[model samples]
Target: MNSQTELAALLCSRLCHDMLSPVGALSNGLELLADEDDPEMRKRCIELLEQSAAISTNKLKFFRLAFGAAGGFGDNVPVEEAQEVINALAAGNSRIELNWAVEEQSLPKPAVKVLLNLAQIGIDALVRGGTLDIGAEKRDGNVEIVTRARGGKIAFDETIGKALQGEIAPVEITSRTAAAHMIALLADEMGGGLQYALSDDALVLGAVLPQPEGMIG
Candidate 1:
């Protein structure tokens, strides 16, 4: 299959796989709630339904921005909105903490996209649960995005690392690394670049994109 078609399929596969778990839980919880006769079991089913719904919703929001068309007419998205999505994703794991360091109240669409995906990479890298710190800044007509994950026994998939650097063969790309491939493509298309360093206890990914002329900080 052609790379484009393969990439599209992989992205779809990834989204469907992510949505299936919570969506399935929501369905199962509803089924249990319907049959349960005891008060405590019914209450527990309700709680499970609530949690499943939240998870599904959060994944939707996160994917909307990262993979789908999400922003309005403007080419910029509010930093707070972006941060909220990240926080929601992080909240799902109590062992992981998020530190958002972007000072800008608003950011260009590309910047936000880069920020979100890079942050996700950091989150995934922390296998043992860790702190994910995301930062973005604009200066001298450019944007700098960075995500760092630190924890005990951290490990990152090397395939993802190569994909993020645009070093992976198209034939080797899969659903798991499609986002990284896209990120690398965007960076190269913008005349910017992606950099990363992975270690046993830490992982860092960053990108630099040149802002449009007259773009505000």
Candidate 2:
């Protein structure tokens, strides 16, 4: 197979590997909760169950928009949906602030995936308390998505940036870097480009994607 196809398959496998643990834990917790008899234990189990369910659902939704096909139900996906996806990824712990310039524009699936993946990377970079700003603007028939994470200390392993730039070796691209590389490839496929910059207290990622021809309003 060609290099692009191989990279895509590798990325898909990496995503599945990362998601399997949490999803498996969720299933196991549910099974255990169904058999528990003690009220207090059952209550705790229920809490765990709820938390796990939320994680699974939110992660799946975010990944669907980021790494998989999005805008599944309709011709256009609302901006609100993208906002919801980000909030879900944050999961109440990470305080993410979103600023969207194109409220009425419907992004193509590839653009949405690249944006979501970049957001995920930004979230990961801001482990400590921080603010993540996401913006999307359309100019000259091209869509630009920008994500910036500013906080106490933005810490991201170097490998992720390497993967985003398509410079990392395939075997060295772990689950952490898989999403970034996938997003970068998606941007390239859409006739766009990805860029990343890191400052002392902030990390910024940007993607510029060309809009598809003959797209209706």
Candidate 3:
């Protein structure tokens, strides 16, 4: 298979693998709650069950839009939906603040995936509590998505950056690195490129994706 097709399959598998644990835990929690005799324990289990279910559902929805093919979506997805997806992913994670600056433009599926992956990377970079600024702008006939993670001692791991450059060997495409590499590959496929820089307790990931003819309308 071609590289893009291979990458698509790999990404799908990676997403499923990443989600399985939380979803399974949610299922188990429900079962435990159903079987528990103690009212207090059952109540606590129910709460856990609810939280787990919500996390699984939200992550699944966000992944569908971000990595998988968003069902019934037109050539360009609505900006509101994208924002909602990000918000869902960020639920209960107050350490990272998401700031969106996207125009009311519909982005192609690939472009959306690239943006989401970059957002995920930015979120990961801010392990020590920080602000994640996500913005999209149209410039010179291309759509550019920029993600900045600001925090104390921010560092972008070298392995991830290398994977983003398409130098990741198959064996090195572990779950930890797959998302970032996928974003870079998507940017390359769109006839654009990715740029990354580290500045003053912040790491920035920027990708420019080519806009298809008549896609915005």
> How big is the RMSD of model 2?
2.7
**Superposition error at 68 for model 2 (Å):** 1.9
- Give the TM-score comparing model 2 with the true structure, all chains together: 0.84
Clashing pairs in 2: none
1-217 per-residue lDDT for model 2 (tens digits): 2366666777677768757877888888889888999999989988887887787788778767766656656544666777788887786574555444555456667777777788878888887868888888667888888889888889988788887777778687655676777777777787888888999899999888888876533
Q: State which candidate, 1 or 3, has the greater TM-score.
A: 1
Q: lDDT of all the models against the reference?
A: 0.86, 0.76, 0.78
**Best prediction by lDDT:** 1
CA deviation > 4 Å runs, candidate 2: 1-5, 31-35, 73-76, 92-102, 169-171
Q: Is candidate 2 or candidate 3 better by lDDT?
A: 3
TM-score of each: 0.95, 0.84, 0.86
Q: RMSD per prediction, one decimal?
A: 1.4, 2.7, 2.5
Worst 10 residues of 1 by lDDT: 1-10
> What is the Å distance of residue 67 in model 2 from its true position?
1.9
Clashing pairs in 1: none
Q: Is candidate 1 or candidate 2 better by lDDT?
A: 1
